[model samples]
Target: MTAVTDEGPGQVRGQVAGQGPGPERGRNPDEGSAPREGLPKDRGRPGRDWDDGLIARRAVSGAAPQEAPAAVPDDDVRPQVEAYVPSGSPLSPRLDALRELVGLSRARLDRTDLAEAGRVLDEAAARQRLSSRHTVVAIAGASGSGKSTLFNTLAGAQISEAGLRRPTTAAPIACSWTDGAAGLLDRLAIPGRLRRRPQQSGTGGDEALQGLVLVDLPDHDSAAAGHREQVDRVLALVDAVVWVVDPEKYADAALHERYLRPLAGHAEVTFVVLNQIDRLPGEAADQVLDDLRRLLDEDGMALGEHGEPGATVLSLSALTGDGVGELRELLGRFVQERTAATRRLSADVDAAAARLRPVYVAEGWPGLGERAREEFADRLAEAVGAAAAGQAAERAWRRNAGRACGTPWLRLWRWYESTRQPRGLDRTVFAAPPEEQLTARQRVEQAVRTVADDAADGLPGPWAQAVREAAVRGAQGLPEALDKLAARAGAEPGRDTDTDSDNGEPAEAAETAEPGGRTGAHRGRAAGRPPRPAWWPAAVLAQVAMTLLQIFGGLWLIGQIIGVLEPGLLTPALVMLAGIIGGPLVEWSCAAAARGPARRYGQEAERRLREAAAGCGRARVLDPVAAELVRYREVRERYVAVTEFSTTRG
Candidate 1:
């Protein structure tokens, strides 16, 4: 019996009838005394058993080792092999996450990075569609690390230059295993001159690596700036990276600090190779590999998930081909999994999100308080001259009330005094003082600015600026609006009658007799009633009777003096005194009674005017300011939503 050998990675040797193990290689546990139907009398010393060496080789190569077949004879055994199974694409979900971020933040944030991320997604998607089966693995290393030699050895030909040129592999070289990778190569910007084809003999086990495209990149630490740039550019776009480091420079700080440290999260598709181990003894190679792993751990990289050191730490000599088969096997498995692209994209997203975490952090979202709102409103009222207007209305009402109900004898003097208009009005209603003349307009404008500034306090720069702008916009036409609103409010209440019309006629008194206004109008109108009291006629009749009595007394006294009647001087004089005193007392009493009505009318007028002015202030100033506050709140909510994702992700 002969042991089957694999020439290239994952290639299986041909099986002979009844002379070897099953089609799949590996020693069967029950093979010691099994009889076969074939006529070979004696199986030559049992074919080399698939032992620890083979299993260890596959394990170190990042491949899942298959179970050994049963030792049952060929008549009863039939091997089943699955050729290819594709891992579902992970790029779709990652792209969706990226797009979600862009959708929410583009309007509010600096989108330069987001735009670049979008480009990456688009390019990645297009590349995957054109060549889903292809796995782009780039060979990256610092200068003099045997990266090109490994690339050549992997290609099974002299594809990349491997000699003593300082900063070799100036341009990237792509080695494709199968046809149809031309479009993908173009997308990667690999020139036709740098492209090569690896030799392919048969399908079988080699079919697993059919779509693998290996790239030889320029030195990462190359003195030539362009060479380093080339390495960086290819590293960002490739599906996987195999970092080739020799035993001598395995722990170089330039490689770990600049590249590995930053790419810690990308360990899934990262490979750290300890190349040129032929220079070191077996034990020394092991020690070097250990030290290299320690350095990788310090850089915060987790290996093994995607064929990197965490899974299998490789120490091979690209010059002598020693231990090269293990690496090929790992590459074969990596290509078969077909997950490198998705893994690469996912890591990129993670890195992008990490960079964006700071901008999305939270302080707190407590909104404007009720106290602030009321304070602002009060300021606005003062600015609109609401208080002054109210006071003027009160004074004007009192003047009108005094003229209407004051003593009839003094009416002329009172009317003359009242005809002079109050300080700021021609009518009994309230209006805003002229905007330009009134200090209130400027005060109101300042109050608007103050309120806006207050609302924006403690907010982020962009959001705070937004709130301020909204407030400024709301206040743009406010001064003029206040004036118009005040005029309208003042006119709306007393439209029915021109009670305060400028005139000195008795008709003015008649007009004042109509119902007064405001909260106190009921009492005012009742008090201002000018109709004669029920007993007023009686008082007048009594006064007339007293006068007649005085006249009779006087006549009697005169007759007596002339010697026509008996003496009555005392009675005649007393009657005259009573008539005079009673008339004056009644007049004084009526005047006293009218005072209450006049005062009530004044109060009612003042109340109405104040209400009108306040209404105007609310409409023209407070309401618009409130609308701006509402807008700020809405934007705040949107901002919070946009930043919330970052918070949760971080």
Candidate 2:
């Protein structure tokens, strides 16, 4: 067993598994355990928390503590994300979760903030591939904390200089107990000259530490910025860490705030060592250790008490070798268990999740509503003038009905008037007020805006903007489409006649009968020929018969005045009266018969225009908005997958 010198690191020279000072030579250790630096002398002793911790690993690979170590020679540098994370491993979901997260951000989000996540995953994979047998633990501390001396004591050799300024050697020093750690040291960027072997040859009575690669990091509070940078870099790359703090600088704010606090989640892979505790006077070492625990708690770093689950805390003196055996035995189990890589990676994920959690949308998602869709359709119909078209249709029906059923004299009068002037239903039917037509374009724009807002509501900024853009794209030709829908004459779309047919488009302008249209289009219903009433022919016959009677009676009167034979004045006068009055009665009856049918046809025409307008809107604005909403929900699910891992992990 080996003990340490208080005044100089050189006192332990040439003692690399050779003749080092015994427990009797130095002041008694804080733990009063073995004389050796790492090997415990009080084996099988009661209240030995250090020995109890070495029971066995939690069986991560289903291998016992005595199971053979993995061979550490391979050529894998950069494996695919999935290839590294086997099917049933704890890290399997993390690959997809993080990959999906990054993919979504690049494709849809405004800024992908977690670039470190990639490095974390890559390092995890790279570590897994390198050496399963080895565990690389770094000894980190502020300048003048004697972490280098602690590093040397652990290796059983003066491999690192005690008081060397970090500016002279900005890079970390590495010592591997096993032979296959060259690649691992290379990955840490430790130059070949800085690499050391704990023994001159063989295991050298340190078989329990066979797979340990201990690193002496550059001082954390080094005035040379490069030294601090090196410290940060190596800490990120290492499997586990032992933070060395003397009693004076144990509660240093820079150390806690910059490193420990941020890395609190990694308590499992952490070792908080109260180094140089022999310098504490009286029972003050215990008090200092307790105060350090309090500071760690404030930093959100949990401490393991009575073998509970938390960070491994210990007080040791690299000089007097006090509690040094306890620290080494605990580390022996930590390295042999071989779970540092997994724990470090899991903590990295926890950290990544914390960084991204603030911006995550936790509320239930808002969807595209059916009510919004109907409102959008209604807007489009109004913009296209379906209401006004219905009125025009009714008027057109009346004009056509009058031609079929009116008295011959009245029909002749209407024909004469048509030659002079025609208003509302004059041949080309749809004649909405100019004011209503003027607002059609504005109404269409409003409809698009409203639907876009509804669809984009409650969405993230980039996704919301995407939905709006899709809506705008769909609305590009909508106004023209609506106009074409409503601007039809008295016919259905894409047909030659106002009636149903297989013929081509109308040849003449009047034949086309432009009616249902928006804004610039004729804003009214198509007034194609309306169906004739059943009694039209009968009404024509009766009117013609009355006219003949009037003619006969008038002739009879004229003959009587001319002194022709047998002329009765009462008969002629009654006949003439009957004919004139009957003509008026028949005309009135025909006008009443045409009214109901005319109104029905008008309504049907308007409905067709409205439906067309609605369909156009759905194709243009609503469908695209709906798709965007779907895409966003998909992105949201991906985000959940990414964050779910953090919550579920310890």
Candidate 3:
């Protein structure tokens, strides 16, 4: 049999007893009562009997103990306790280890994880408040809520100097029980002097209230924002809260909507004290308390009497110590309950754990595979090759035309003949005007751009943008690509030879029309002019120099034949001609022969642009997405662990 117990307000404590139906059915011989084997014995002291009764009630209600409490006898009770332990339950140590692992995973994620981890850590810290040994209960309210007055009343003296002046408490003041445990003040970084409380001789021993650390924080509604900030900072780190509100402003929308509502999850560690209750008419106090309770409930606070182990709403006059005894008694009982420390610590840990969870979460992203990268590289290379081929072909055509017909001296004549005068030549053979013709260089550039644009198409959002940018860059590099192509073409200057003017032919009529004379007359006149006797014979002898010219001409012809027949010279010249003229022809032929390869290369270049775009996309866009995913995973893990812990501990 399992016995369950509800300890103060929200807590449930359970105890399991009794074995399953056993062979021994005999009753206890000494007591002569029904067998005690399966019955729960009430072992609590007289005054504490309610706790045991509650445990029995919880057990009867089927709320089994999560783990066997130390007091259960081992002989028969151990097996029953084992049976009651839930299967697949994660022990506290296991959960802690898992949380640590989650923390480590979060650390590896980038900036998004860092921010998320910070938030998770904050939540875990808040949760730890539930289990802290020393409770730093801060009394917070607007000015004239008698917060300082309440602080003094709680401390049993005029510890905080209260006045009508606005923002009277400039800084925080702490009061602690003198006989309480030591080190808590030091842990909180509070100096020993600030730990003083007003000496009080009481109906209840003051020593019972030891371990209580009460703080009088600055007013949250002070005109100075810094005061409010300080109040907020202290509130976050404190173990619990005592929200002091006067009857008139107990339901202040700003206070409830802003502070109270947001902190609804911390209700287990909160108390609402309606201070200055004496100001209300005697009968109205009860009504005001009820209203306050209802408001707190609306804000998700559970309210009851003190020592109820949940949130409580109480009306009191801090000035006159009205209801102060009940408050002291409740606080004393809470102090005596050692689990308060564990609860506060656990709560803080939970909060911090939550903040850290987002840092550990893992998210998936769209990634380009290795095959895609290879494909992109190949495409880019092919695009560049095609551009090179086109440029080479154009260059070859230009060189061949220049060698065959162009010259510096005759260029103007050729231009005039081709343009204005129709020399019985085909007009259709002329090169296009610069405006109409796309240069080899321009063609390459356009091709590259086209390839890039095609590759960029159909990509996802930011990736598409990246692909477009990469394509632009690749296209802009086309001029350099063309220059490489031209270098590889290796077109050299062609040989130039002029026709001889001195042929043994008669002068044309145009030539003979010299300004001086007709051709025959000129010749006869030249013949009549010279007849010097012995000197003329010698001049004729000197004029007959053809023998020397003949000898030199014969030698030059022999040298020409020798050069033409030499294998090295002939082979090189032939090869040069083939490359200059044939290279472009070959490219054009290949462009026709292998159009598939050329188009494929162009497509490949586009693919490369897409890949480079993907890398850039990861850097700019995917990184943030991955980080967010990491955060989400971390949060989910912590949320799971926390809910699990809450269930186990319930």
Candidate 2 lDDT score at position 195: 79
**2 against 3, candidate with superior TM-score:** 2
Tens digits of per-residue lDDT for model 2, 61-109: 2221221222322222332122223356556577567767766667655
lDDT digits (tens) for residues 60-173 of candidate 1: 223332223222211111222221113343345445556666665566556653544465556555655666667889898866677888887787667687655665578999
Cα deviation in Å at residue 72, candidate 1? 42
What tens-digit string does per-residue lDDT give for candidate 3 at 381-464? Answer: 333333333332233333233322222323445444445534333211222234322343354444444443444334333333
Against the true structure, whose lDDT is highest?
2
Point out the higher-scoring one by TM-score: 1 or 2: 2
Candidate 2: deviation at residue 144, Å?
Answer: 2.8
Q: Per-prediction TM-score, please?
A: 0.59, 0.71, 0.42
Off by over 4 Å in 1: 1-114, 199-208, 247-258, 277-329, 354-362, 366-379, 386-413, 418-442, 450-460, 496-650
